[model samples]
Target chain A: MKIAVVGKGGSGKTTTSAVLARTFARHGHDTLALDCDSNPNLGISLGIGEEATEALVSVRDAVDAGEEQHATSMDDLVSRFGVDAPDGVRLAVVTAIQNPEPDCP
Target chain B: MRVAFVGKGGVGKSSLSGSFARVLAEAGERVLAIDSDPMPGMAFSLGLEQSDAGLPDDAVEEYEEDGRQRYRLREGLTGTDAVEQYAQRAPGGVHFMQLGKARGPQWNNRRQHFGFQRLLDDLPGDGWSIVGDLPGGTRQPFLTWGRYARTFLVVIEPTPASLLTGRRLARLAETARAPRVVAIANKVREPGDAERVSSRTGLDVIGSVPFDPALADADRLGKAVLDTDPDGPTATAVRSLVQTLQKSEEQS
Candidate 1:
């Protein structure tokens, strides 16, 4: 089933969500944990080493850089970017925007 | 059963949320957690380093491409396929994705659709619990998603603003047809604080937590309070919250 944890800043939304994700992963079910917050620190809670992930490139950036067309087809996105399932659990990222400041170590 | 934990700012919702999840995991329950807030500092409280999962600048595309809403990001990521490649699998067996940040336009449309919600169709089976950490405000995203949740937990404080919002949330939940609504009092120091808030707001108090400096210190140092103080008052309160909710669900 799906569960969502939401609260104000300093109210423990991220901590609760991250811990729940870790706890679920520990329980051994194929689970997907998502950190869709603007502060962007869910990767750190999961013990990821760096802030860099190939999953972050955006369609807007591709267009701004002239990497794609003004109206790229959805089929083009799947063919060029999507990949087969990976080892362990599956992790995905979705957001409306990125941070102006770098949130890396 | 699924559980959604929601509250405003400074209510210790994150600590309680993560701690409750830890309690369930220790008891052999499969739990997945989703963080939907903009600040995204819950990582430190969950015993993980502080880092971002995705970059917002590239995640969503905003153009009225056609009659349908089309979005694409990450040159090598999934498109229109209803899934993205930026999600990362955590060590504890949970697969995680980044909702990153919302642009001003998307934030304005917070009442609309959260692209992440699409993952609901891809969740696990029964006996699994999922928790999401949301932002501080009682805006459309929380209210809208609150409608979809089977159980809604509102975090409250003794202050008028907090209690007022808590009650408003309860009414909204009732209006939206949430499966269940419960309130939690965080950092309760004054006697009858929860009761006072409840009596004035006319909402049931299902949980309470005491203030602790250890939690604040952990936040400053970038560490999980569980790792620092598992037996602390806040932790114990959170564990009890899990048991209480689990029992409530069982009885239901």
Candidate 2:
């Protein structure tokens, strides 16, 4: 089952998402938690240590910085960019805008 | 003094900004609260009954610039004029305005975004003390939404997640050449919480708001903390914050 949690900032969306993802994984479901926020911090909420969570680069940033090649398929993307969190949940950050260029569309 | 409240999502920026504006207005300052978040949150904090009100559709005009679609405030209307014409009167006589809220996937309030940006750019610097409540995350600051403000008050909480985001936001604001960037620690429970946030984010904690359940209850009830509990800890802290900001502004 797929779930998308949405709310205003600081409204417990990340906390709720992390709890739900962990619960599903512990129930024997193969869960993949996607952090799509520009300021992604789901890893920290998912029991990943702060250093490791901050070190996990988003796929968009990696590709934009020319540090990694783009994945050609969904399975390739998951394997190439996804990290294993606690409880066997796969965590992948889709995108992030760290330093946007001035007046770039 | 023009200021923008920015930080991670859910960091109590709206609460502090709304309360700060009302306090400033009560002190006889002409205060304009600009809610740059498309989520429509500042209204609730400003004690305005309508949460979704924004500038009228006719306030903006669409045009093409450099082969790109762009939006601008309608001709003959300056930013100050827009505020006077469209800003809603909140409690304590604070004038509140917002970028239109997102309606759906396809309707993303694009015009309002660009129009408000233009309006902010054209706003005069002499009259009102503008308080901008920017959207969460790094996008708006990176895009220079808070450029008009002379200072950036990055509201932070005592969490690793909040600290990381706060650090990034501070760097972005500095990179944009913002005149000043300071941290306002919120939801601080322990004695060392503010220091921890300041150390992690590398910013001076100018003001700290204690973790108050009354503020949360106000949020749940769609009411401002000042109105819900006038003498509450959160309100008292925010009033002090306003004083600090004003004093610094005077000195600078």
Number of the top-ranking candidate, with lDDT as the measure: 2
Instruction: Give the residue spans of candidate 1 off by over 4 A.
Output: A1-105, B54-66, B70-97, B100-113, B125-127, B141-143, B146-148
- Against the true structure, what is every candidate's RMSD? 19.4, 2.3
lDDT tens per residue, model 2, B38-72: 66578888998775557776889999999999989
TM-scores of chain B alone in all candidate structures, in the order given: 0.78, 0.92
Q: For residues B35-116, could you state the per-residue lDDT of candidate 1 as single tens digits?
A: 6654545555566665455434544454446685644443443332323344333434433333434556554432113344
Interface DockQ per candidate: 0.08, 0.60
Taking all chains together, each candidate's TM-score versus the true structure is: 0.59, 0.92
Query: How well does candidate 1 score on lDDT at residue B209?
Result: 81
What's the residue-level lDDT of B113 in candidate 2? 71
- Residue B103 lDDT in model 1? 52
Compared with the true structure, all predictions reach lDDT values of 0.57, 0.85
Q: Where is model 2 chain A poorest over a 10-residue stretch in terms of lDDT?
A: A96-105
